[model samples]
Every structure is written in C-alpha cells, then in structure tokens.
Target: MKRETNRRSFVKLAATAGLCTLASPAVLAGSHPEQLAENEETNKIPKKSWYPLGVFKNPVLESVFLFYVGSTWQRLSDVGECFDTASRIDEANDYSWSDQWIKTGNRLKVLGDACLKEHHEFTAGESYLRSSTYYRAALHHYPDPANKIVKELSLKVVKNYKMALKLMSIPFEAVSIPYMKTELPGYFFPAKLKSNKKAPVIILHAGRDSWAEDYLWVAQQAVKRGYHCLLFDGPGQGKVIRIQGIPFRPDWENVITPVLDFLKHTKKEVDMNKTVLMGFSMGGFLAPRAVTVEKRIKLCVANPGVLNWTASIYNGLNQIDPQLLPLFQAGNYDLFDQKIEEYMRTSSYVKWGITDELWKYGVHKPSELIKKYQEYNIEAVAKNIGCRMMVIDGTGEEFSVGEAKRLYDALTCPKDYVLFTEEDTGYLHCQPGALAIAYTRIFNWVDKYIDVI
Candidate 1:
C-alpha cells in the first residue's frame, strides 16, 4: 500500500465520492472504485457550518460536507440540519449524496415559499439561501455538466440567492461588467455606513467550482465591517460559464480591470483608494494575478497563494505508478487521456472535477485542461505586484500542498504569510471550518493597512 500524499489522496477521493450523475445512479451506488490522482489548485474550499464533520469515512465527501455545512457562519445554511443529513446519508453508498442534498433543498424551498406567501421576507430569504447553498453543494460531486440537473441546480442556486438578497435590508444590485463582446455578471452590496464618506471596497473572487453567490460569506462579513463588497463571476465562473458560454482566460487582469473601471459608474460612495482584492480557492491565485497589473487594489489576499498553478496541478505526478508526464513526452496522448479518464470511472470527485473544468475551460479533454492551466501562473509577474499582499494557507491541504508558501516566497512587495494549524481546527484548505476566524484575521490585517470603514 502506498502512502497517499496530500494530492495523491484525490485518487481515493474519487472512490470516496463514488459519485454518479443524476442521469445515472444505480450502477455506481455502493460501488467504490479506485482512481488516479491529479491535483489542481482547488483544495482550498469546503464545509457549511464552520465546524468540520469527521463522521464520514471518505475524505472527499468529508470535504464536500465541510464546504456547505460551514456556510452557517454566513447565514446561508443551518449547521444542525446539515449534520443530520450527513448522518443519515450513508457515506459509502455512492450517488445518493447529491440526491439527498436536493431533497433537503426542496424541503427548505417549501418552507421558504410558504414564508414568502405570508409576507415574512426575512425568514423566507434565510430559508431560500440555505436551500440554494444545499443545491450548490449537491453539484460538488455530481459528475456531468451536460446533465440537466447541473444547469437545474445552478439556476436554483442563483434564484434562491437573489431572492435572499432582495429580502435583506442591504443596498444590493445586479451588475453587468463589460468584457470582450460579452458581459460578466456580478452583485454589489454597498456598506451604507451612516457617515457620508465613501466606504472602502473589498472585491470578492471565487475560484473554480464556486459561483459568484458562493462568495456571499466574504461579502456578508465585509459589509458588516463597513466595506463595500463587489463580487463577480469571471470567465469560466458563475453565469459566465453557465449562460454566456465563456471559458477561462489566463490573463485575469483583463477580468479585474473591467471590474475596477465599473466601480466609478456604480454611483455609490466607494473609496477606490482603499480597495482590496481577495481571492478564494483557486481565486487565491486569480486575485493576486490581477493585482500584478491593476494597482488600484491597496490590499491583495490569496487564501492560499499559488505559484505556477500548472506545476501545482502536477505536483504529485512523480508518485503515480505509471507517470502521466512520460506519456505526454512520448506523444502517447491517447493513452495519457485514457488513464486520466479511467479515474472518472472510479471516483466521483475526479469525474466532477474533470468534467466541470473541461466545460468551464472550453476544452475537450483532460490534457487540454492542463495545456490551458499552463498559461495561469504569476511567478514571472510577482515582482510587478505593487500592492500589499497577504497569503493564507492551512495544514492538511487536499489539493495545492505548500503552494501558499511557494507563492509567498516569490513576492518582492510587502507581504505577510499566515498559516492555520490543525490545532486551530483550520487544517483543511482555506480553514473551511473556521471561517469566522479566517475573516477576522483577514479584516484585522486589512485594517492595519487601511481604514476600512
């Protein structure tokens, strides 16, 4: 038996998921198949309630559960019910996780609908938010983007999130950011502080697998601290990938530049001078990558700073029984692709990760995904980042092990590196179970550089 290093664990994460599409489930239920591991830069997201659930035997499902359940702190989910659902859902009995999550979401939608009928908007909104978070989490291990449920759940996520936003007592609006022959969809929540002064801004960015709405946790906290929050789905994220059909672009500065340009036109009192760019998950890389050129951001936060995302993706290549790199070097592309796909059959996480990324990136196969990712790194431009930077990382990272330190060491600008240890219950990527602590640390650090309020 081989010692599964951080990412090699993803191979097992697949079988741990044993997840199947909504289109087909019977064939995969209770059948855990082993998979090949290919690490990406997405190990930084997980949990709903901010308390990690170690009840599940499978680490992949553990991560999925952690991500959505940790949403309690954001008021997007109920931690108690999420725990009950996890307990009832058999971890090894594959393919039922998404279905069960949908059931829970449906139940909440019912309650929310009743609340709305009775004109209790606040209660209704809260229920809808939880419903949407469940629906969003359901997509975690769901393997096929072509499946109707993928789009169905995505629509439900936005629908519920919007309803919740509309019912809230905050200044909110939907925004369309002009891009190349298209527009990026986003949301804005102004701090609306009592003072007439412009509020400092915190631009929120979510990485692969998370949508624009998934970033509400950060925005919720920022708004409380009197910061105007801007969240947008870049190419390959949120509505961009779902509706407009745009793939990811390596030059993310193009994405952030337009966002910064649009802030002035928002007609709100936003302090552009104190703007902050904070990235989550794979976004940890995207945010810093953007600051390399867009200097308007006074503070840049990478939850786990990443160096060469391409190198990070292939970090565990040497440990595989038959290395994937050699196949590429020998031009045995078919075999290389076949081996990658073999994981799809064995692991739910691999299936979902590969398929979802392929669709988001507008690539046909796994190899093409790698080719596309090769263009998404900041090592060459790290020195060009003029803004103050902060790097965050947690121990026991599932995907990008040690990437934060690698990125922190590459910077030439003023920087800070914060490590979350297992003792603090922040061992998993992004400290999913300790979000309040995560945001508190971030805001306190930002406060040192700028007067956020």
Candidate 2:
C-alpha cells in the first residue's frame, strides 16, 4: 500500500475560521490502537451479565465473542467513559457540571473554528457544533426543571442547529429520534430536504454513543456533491440510548420504517428511487440490515461497519475484567460510590455498568436491549441486500476491520473496498484518516453507478 507520509500537512483547516486541536495518537503512543492490541485480544467484554443465558445461546454476544479478539478501541471505550461524565453534569445550573458542559461546547467550537479557518474542511467546526447540540439536549433533561429547562435548552439547540446548518450549501432539517413513542426530549437535527427534481438520497445511521449531529462532516460533503442526506439517531444511539435506555433493535424495521415513510411522503428532492443507506461503527451493522427489508435503499455503505453487536459489546466488556460483571448486569449503582474518574479505572468499560447519576435520570439496562440484538442478526439478511455496496476500512482502525472485510467478501452486490493507512492519514475511526481522500473516493464511486443508471 502506498502510504501518504505528509499526513500532518494533509490535515488542512477550512479557511480563516479557527484552530482546534486534533486528538492525534501520534504523540501518545499508549493511546494508539496498535499499542493496546494485546489487551483487546485477551479481554472479552464479559457476557456473564450481558448474556444471562450464557454466551452460546445469545447470538449477538456470540458474535461479539468472535469479532473483538484484540482491539484498542475497547480499552479506550473504558477510558472514554469519562466523556459520559460530561453528560452527567448539570448543563444549566450546577457550576461544576455547567462549566464542564460549557467548556466542552466551547472546545468543540474551537475545533470547528479551526476547521473553518485553517483546515478549510471544517470537520472540527462541525464536531464542535455537534457537541454543542448534545450539550443543549442534556440541558433539556436537567432534573431541576426549575426554569422550564426544556424551553430554555430548546432555544440553544435551535441556535446551534441553525449555526451548523447555515454553513452547508444544501437544504437541512433536524429531528428528535422518537424513543418509546416520544421525540427524545431535547435532541434535534435536520432529517430530510425536498429537492425540486429527483436527487439521490443518503440515509445515515449513527454509531454507538453518537447522534445525528455526528454526520455534519459527512452530510456537508454529500450536499455539496449534489446528494440529499438524511441523518437520524437509531435506538441505543446518542440520547435515546443514553437517556431512554432504548437498546438497539436488530429488526431495524421498527426504527427506520417510520423515518422512511416520513421521507417518502414529505420530501420531493429525496429520490425514493435512488436511495442509499450508510452506517458507521454500530450503524455499519444497522444499514446492512435495513437495506434487506427497505428495498427503497438502492445502495449500501458501511464505514468501518459492524457485522455483530454481541461481539462488539463482548469486546468492550472484556477490557474491564469479569470481576465487575455483576455491577453491569444489575444496571444500577449498587456496587461502589466511586467518582467518575475512578469509575473510569475500575469498571470493565467505564460506561458498561450503569451509573447512579444515569439512573437518577431514568437510564437503566433494559435486558431486552441485549435480547433485541441477539434476535436481529444481519448475516441472515446479508443475502437479501440486492443493492450495490461499498465498504471503507482504515488499516489503523481497531474497531471492526476483519468483520468489515468478511462482510465485503460475503456481499453479493457489485461492491468495492477502500483502505487507508495511518502514515497516509490520521488514526480516525470513521475514515477520518484522510477525509478529503475518503470523501473523494465515496463521491467518485457514487457518481459511477449513479450517472450510468
């Protein structure tokens, strides 16, 4: 593979916006994916609690058992649990929590500014806007309700959404992924845009611990290239997963059908005839499954796709050791009263076990969530995906490379596989390795099958 050695130079910003620091593992070797490979190989995200019936009977956990043999992202999932602590903070009043939320939002803004001004790509700026959206959503659910937090938070959410939306060239929309029937309280982002003529549509499914906002970078790219993008949060994603305890549903029919129906009825620009569904991380698994049933999806794209959720969870659980399995299984903070930082060190993967603050917010492990994944295996549906497909994998990504390759080989569609190296780009999970290169490849591929048809 030809490596792009001028990675730092290639990491450009979007004009004179601002400079935001990139979390490059180049300086921190321990944080690099390759460094933590040994732990990932041996440690299994314990199915002890994840699979009350044992790993064999549970297909999802069984799949997880197969995939995450050795991965650094699982270890980082433990450490990165610290990011959730920010969610635990009070965004409106509690000074400590509020300050943290503000700082995080501001830091994201700085990142966005850096992208807008320096990189010209403005991914950091989009990231900042995305984080701001989450922070505002958190405020909407603040326990106090002293000041009608929802109303106050909605204003900020709208502001951030508008700021992010204005930067793009195409029409944008926001949506609150309905969870258990209600629009997830404060979370919102644009969903679909109406085009005068038939325009190719992109349906985006978010990854674990992600929201619709995470797609700002990808959506912006799609719109500029003349595609209408639909970004939505699925169950167990973003606030719905974190706040409502709605675990993922493998029979994605329940989650995406309504969204598709809405698009079919509401948007003219969305070419129902030329739609593609794309997923990253967990969505990698999700988009594939959706395409099986939703024939409206003419093509599928899995960016660092996931074939098995059980394996994903098990891999994550393995990093923390089996001793703490009971705490995670119980789904409450009955075990220890450790602060968030210590919780990071002690728990198998910091967020695997439910926290007290989280429970106080009504978050709990609905065991059904795990069963949902177990019940909905995509391999059974892979043969059903008649659409042409594409899989993008980074050599540096630790999450699901082998699994993605297996799916790519199994897929019967006219498909292509794109790979990236760290020396050529940064170590990013969703092909952020060299985004310009990745996006170029994606658009070029779409143009090929799209125009000829």
Could you list the CA RMSD of all candidates, in the order they appear? 7.6, 13.5
For candidate 1, write residues 341-403 as lDDT tens digits.
Answer: 875666555566667678877999777776787888888898898888999886655456677
As a whole number from 0 to 100, the lDDT of residue 230 in candidate 1 is: 87
Worst 10 residues of 2 by lDDT: 12-21
Worst 10 residues of 1 by lDDT: 19-28
> Which parts of model 2 have CA positions greater than 4 angstroms off?
1-98, 104-155, 163-170, 175-196, 239-247, 315-373
lDDT of 2 by residue, 1-453 (tens): 112221111111100000111222222232344534544677833111111112222222122222211111221111132344334443224344434544555555666677777755435435545545546434422334334543444455456555655564335555554434665322212334453466787777765534565455567667767777777766655545544455555677666677777677766556687777777766777787777777766777877655664554334333333433345456544442232234433322123223222332233332333333355456666777778888776654544536677777778877787775554453345643244666677778887776545
Candidate 2 C-alpha error for residue 152, in Å: 7.3
Those runs of model 1 whose alpha carbons end farther than 4 Å from true positions after fitting are: 1-52, 88-94, 194-196, 451-453
TM-score of each prediction: 0.86, 0.60
